[model samples]
Structure formats: structure tokens, C-alpha cells
Target: MSYPESLERYAALGVDTEQALQTLAKTPISLHCWQGDDVNGFEGSTGDSGGIAATGNYPGRARTPEELRSDMNKAGSLIPGAKRLNLHAIYADAPEIPDRTELTSEHFRPWIEWAKEQQFGLDFNPTCFGHPMAESGFTLSSADSRIRQYWIDHCIACRKIAADIGEELRNPVVTNIWIPDGYKDVPVDRAAPRQRLEESLDTVLAADVSKEWNIDAVESKLFGIGVESYTVGSHEFYLGYAVKNQICLCLDAGHFHPTESIAEKISSALQFVPSLLTHVSRGVRWDSDHVVLLDDPTKAIFEEIVRCDALDRTHIGLDFFDASINRIAAWVIGTRASQKSLLLALLEPTDELRKLEAEGDYTGRLALLEATKSLPWSEVWNEHCRRSGVPLDTDWMKDVRTYEKEVLSGRV
Candidate 1:
């Protein structure tokens, strides 16, 4: 069907395709930088990935900050709509290397300048893992006071730097904190470590960082590589902490149990927390960060957020890292899939569905829901790509292949 035919169908259901396109175009989806290099940041401290692992070598994986940025630039060109760059503290590029604890905005001036040039917003994360301090699989929640203090200082510095970057860019940055603090085996005393974590978090957030520049968020995980038995920062832990502190709560798509729905969690978290940060990732069985597709889980996340009218308060970011495929293609594919899901949700006839449910017309709601699936949403998607000046279909793959031949193949 043509674009007009698709629009007519949506209009019949009280859906405004034009409005959805406009809203989607304005929404900023932050892309994770670590995907380009399989989470190996510029810190150069290798060995023991702190429970985060990106499988497969696939040649041309970015080995330097410059290469990663160039790859991101290539991926960004094919992805439509507003975009933001998410950075880890380990990606710092300063005159001299500084430990995570001592990182400042000066270490990221080059990144900030590049982001400005690209007209993209910036988000940040404190590198809480992959360093010598996190080799024990515990950092903030460690029983040792010294270990906890180091991570606390690192988080504080990251928050300050994030705020500074946001102030410089005039866009508030979401500084999310995720720690690989957990025990592989069942701990005799879980309460002690949790207590330490609570205390350390209070100290780290004690500084008065302006919200106008920085938005603080805490991410939770069910389990990870070495921390399978017990994850220190579980969902309940972060939920309670976020609510108590009135901070944003991060719900990673791949961090929960297989049957669990991040879509449901959005409604629950937004009830208490001021805002939310969603890390849209695809997890296979475990938290295997695979490239995202326009799958059911991805669609549900965006649908729920739109239904709850929470887009303004929700920050959407991609968090998958698949090394088996082309790194730049991974970015483009995951990001574009996310964008398509959001667009699908935006095009939903939410008011009609709600009205049917409110009137106890479950039959109509069910029928309408199923029937809407058959509509020409693909046509609308094609129009979106065309309007954005990107490839309307799989043609983007040709561009990526050309890049691989001309650039990536040359990389040793």
C-alpha cells in the first residue's frame, strides 16, 4: 500500500500518522558507545570483565576512541530522528590518563565538542567495573571500607562531571550508576554488604548536584557472569532506593528474568519514582546483550510508556552489544529497531483502546487490537525513512558492506 492508503487506514481508527512521525522525530534515543568496542573502554585495564562480556571477535572492533567515534558517526547517519550519545567514564580522553575516581569533564572535552558538532545530547555512566578495584566482583557493596570508598568517590566524580557536561551543552544528562557488586555463591550475610552499599550511595549522592544539569538513576540486575547466585543491586534494592531518594529508576530490558516484563515494571516504577531510564536490550535466556530487533518485548516497552503518557519523563537508551555482527551495523540495526518500535507505539490508537476498555467492551478492544496489527504500518515506516533521508528498506545494508570493504577491512 502507498503512504496515503496507510494514512487513511490509521485515520479511520483515529490515529494521526503525521503526529506520530513528528513526535518520533523529536524523541531522542541515546545510543550506547560501548557497543562499538564490546564494552572495552579506553581505560586499557583488561582481564576480568566484571561479569559483562561481549562474545565473538568480528574484525574491525574499535580499539581507540577515534575509531569508535568514527563508527558511531557512520551508524548515526543511517538512524533517523534525534539521537544522544551515552558515554562511560573509562572512555575519558584527557591530556593524561586519570583513574575513574579522578575523572573530570576535562577528560571528555573532545567528546563534548564532537557531540556539539553533531548536535547530539550526551548521557554518562561511572565505570564501576572492569578495573582492578572491581576484580573481586564487588565494589560499592564490598565489606572492605576502602573498596567501597573508592567506588563512592568514583561515582561522585562522575556525577559532577555529568552535571558539568550537561551545563555546557544546556541539556540535562542522565547519569546512570550500575555496579557489578554481587557474590557468585550464596553469602552467609547479605545484609552487611547491602548496608555498606546503602551508606556508600548516601555518601556518593551527598553532594549537591543540580538536577537542571544532571539526572541520577540506579540500574538493577537479577544476575550476571560471576554474580549468578546473588546480585547486590537487585531490582527491589534499586526500586526502594530510587523511591526513597526521589531519583530516576533504570529498568534494563535484559536484566530481569525471562518471563518478566519491563513493560509492566514501567507502570509500577513510575508510580513512585520521579522518572525512568529504560535500557532497551535483547537478552537470550540470560543477560546476553544481543542486538535488538523489532520483537515483541521491544514493542511492549514502547507501547507501555506511551500508554502511561510517560515519554516526557522517560529516557530511552539502547544497551545491547553484539560482537558477532558488524559493530556499526549492530548500532544501526538496534537503534533503528528501537526507533521503529517507538514509532509503532506512537501510531497506536491508544484513546480508542482505552475507551473500549473503560466502557467494559473487552470484545471490541480485543478485536480492534488484533485487527490493528494487519494495518499498513510498514508503509508508514517506509515514509518515515524516506522523510528522514535514510534508506527505506534493506538498502542500508549495502552501505554498511561498502564501509566494511573500504574502511573496516583495512583495520588490522
Candidate 2:
């Protein structure tokens, strides 16, 4: 818990420790459900999805909707503050398997019911990869009219399903569209695929879905496993489309070049796009989707958002899958690290820094920024976890280890 001395130290800087804790408590971080099952959805697929693959063969992977939810419950119990579950289209539950194009809200009725019971918000994504239809390495942007139309219909259905789920939960669900469409080698006509993608997106979003229940976002990638030469949905392509269409632009931390940072794009994108959806992920070497750590890159993301006063317009969601370790612990560690970064960002003396920058006092600005790195924000985080009834520090790991022996071990 936060001591009096720590609280007073932060208070002297014109920052409110109580306000930061409360804001962090209210802020909902969307946890990706696929982590529990290594992105192997319930549609009876045998192989790993396109481009993205979760490495390792760790035991106790969730095998059913119930098991996944149970794992999520255990992870959520260890993480303090509000949370929302991010669902992929393939996780849809139904007695009979339905193709991606034929999916509806009924297929996801079980998930909706579970989320209602848990009292958590929900978000959705159209599974644009892994199906036989997408085996050609292109989906919405495929030159073949038949292949492209099938994906377009699937995306349309996903948006409507997202609306119904959001309406049921009374929270607007962010339905993000990310497709693995590109070429491994240099293509003669890169412009044609991007043009087709734009047209397909226009048709998918043509339906009159209310923003009150659903928000549309387009995600971009620099390259994937096979698409190293050229990616159809490049960052520039989606940024232009999102800005022109007035939809949300999703910036993934792992979707860019190694040296690039999504944190620097926050303020720039918000000036044009209506809102931003940030996928908090760690990219080791390339877009490996490693478990997120509270590293400098992740910290800069929250810092920029809070510094720009764009928390209300930005959506935060986790996007990583690691099958190497305890999945539940992966979720708890990544999510708590994100929440801690947000807390540190909130506790910053932003006004003072901005005042210095505005007055051309660059020396003071740098000095204060460096000094903020050594503040007692960790104490404030402990206080938050204490109030929220979650374990503080590594105490939460003991619960995970016990669960592994009792619950997860029996799965095999």
C-alpha cells in the first residue's frame, strides 16, 4: 500500500495519487482470449493460423469455451481494475461448425451470456486468416472476385455480431479488421491489391451500424512470415483510409519496423482520425507477439496518450500469445504491466513539463522528465492492488502455481 510519505511526495508535484489510482481502476484493458488456447479457435482447425504462430507446447491449454473462460477468470482475479475480453470470430460456439461467411450473433450467444455473468465489457475481431478460403495468402484484397467476396461477407457478419454483443453488454465493442494480404516477393502491381482492399472495406462498413454499439477499426502491418517483400495493408494505406472514412485506426506495437514506435504516432493520428485502438504487444526481433513487458516502448505508449489528454479517445487492448509458459500468468503479467505503465503515466507532472517546453526551457523539461523516472509510482500501484483486492507484487504468482498443480494439470 502507498505510505503517507510517498503520497505526499507525489502531491508536492501537483499530481494526485488518488486520482491516478481511481482512473486506473476505472480504465478497462481488453484481454485477448486467444492466449489461453494459442489462437487455436473452436472451428476444428488443425494447423496454425496464417503468418502468426504461437510457439512452444506448454501443457494445460484451454480446450473448450468453458475452459478458456475459467482460465480467464483465474487470470482476471489476479489482475486489479476493470477488464474486457477480446474475442476472435473463430471462438464462436455452436453445435454445428459453420463456415466463416455463415457466422452470426447466435454462434456467439454463449460468449455473450458468459460476459454478462462476469460483468465485463467485450470487443471483437474478424478472423481474417487460417481458413481454407484464405489459404491462397490473400483475403479481402485477393484478385479473385470469389475469394475476396467471401472474406468481405465474413467481415460484414462480424461487424453486425459485434454490434449485437455490444448492445447486450451496453458497451461499444471495437471490431478491428486485420488481414494477412501481401506478397512474399515483389509484386508487379502492389497498387491493385490495396485498391481492392479499400473497396472491400467500403462494402463491409456500408451497413448502418450505430457507433453507440460498435466502432470500426482497421489495423496495418509492415510484414508477416510470408509477406516480407510487400504488405497490402501497410500503415500508410490504413492511415489514409481511416482518416478519410472517419473510423478508428489501430496501431499495433509489433506491426512496424524494429526501430519504429507506435507511441510517436498517437498525437499525430488523433489529429486526423476519430480515435485510436492501440494493440499493446512486444515484438522480439520481428512481429513475434511476445508477452508484453513494462519496457521503455510500452511505457512510452501510455505516456504519450496521457500526456496528450487522449485517454478518452484511445482504446487499449492486449495482442500477444505465448504458449511457452503458464498462459494465465502470461495474461496477468502483461495486463498488470500495462496497468502499471498507465499508472506511471498518470502520475506524471505533465503540466509542468509542458509549461517548460512551451516557455523554451528545454533543459528544465529534460531534467524533470528524467527525474520522474525515479518517483514512488510503484507504491501507488501497490495501493491500487490492495484496494482492488488483488495481490500486490509477486504474491499473485503463488496463486497461479497452485492453480497449475490443481486445475491446469488435470487438463491433460
Cα lDDT listed for each candidate: 0.91, 0.93
What TM-score, computed on C-alpha atoms, does each candidate reach? 0.98, 0.98
lDDT for each residue of candidate 1 in 1-412, tens digit (9 for 90 to 100): 8999999999999999999999999999999999998898887875457788889989998888888888888888898889999999989886687877888999999899999998899999998888888877889998878888899999999999999999999999999999988888888888887888889899988988878999999999999988889988999999999999999999999999988889999998899999999999999998998899999999999999999999999999989998888999999889989988998899889999999999999999999989978888988888988898888667898989999998888888
Residue runs of model 1 more than 4 Å from their true location after superposition: none
Give the C-alpha miss distance for residue 153 in model 2, angstroms: 0.6
**Candidate 1 CA-lDDT value:** 0.91
What is candidate 2's lDDT per residue for 247-280, written digit by digit as tens? 9999999999999999999999999999999999
Candidate 1 weakest lDDT stretch, 10 residues = 42-51
lDDT accuracy of residue 100 in candidate 1: 79
Each prediction's number of clashing residue pairs: 0, 0
What's the distance in Å from true for residue 117, model 2? 1.7
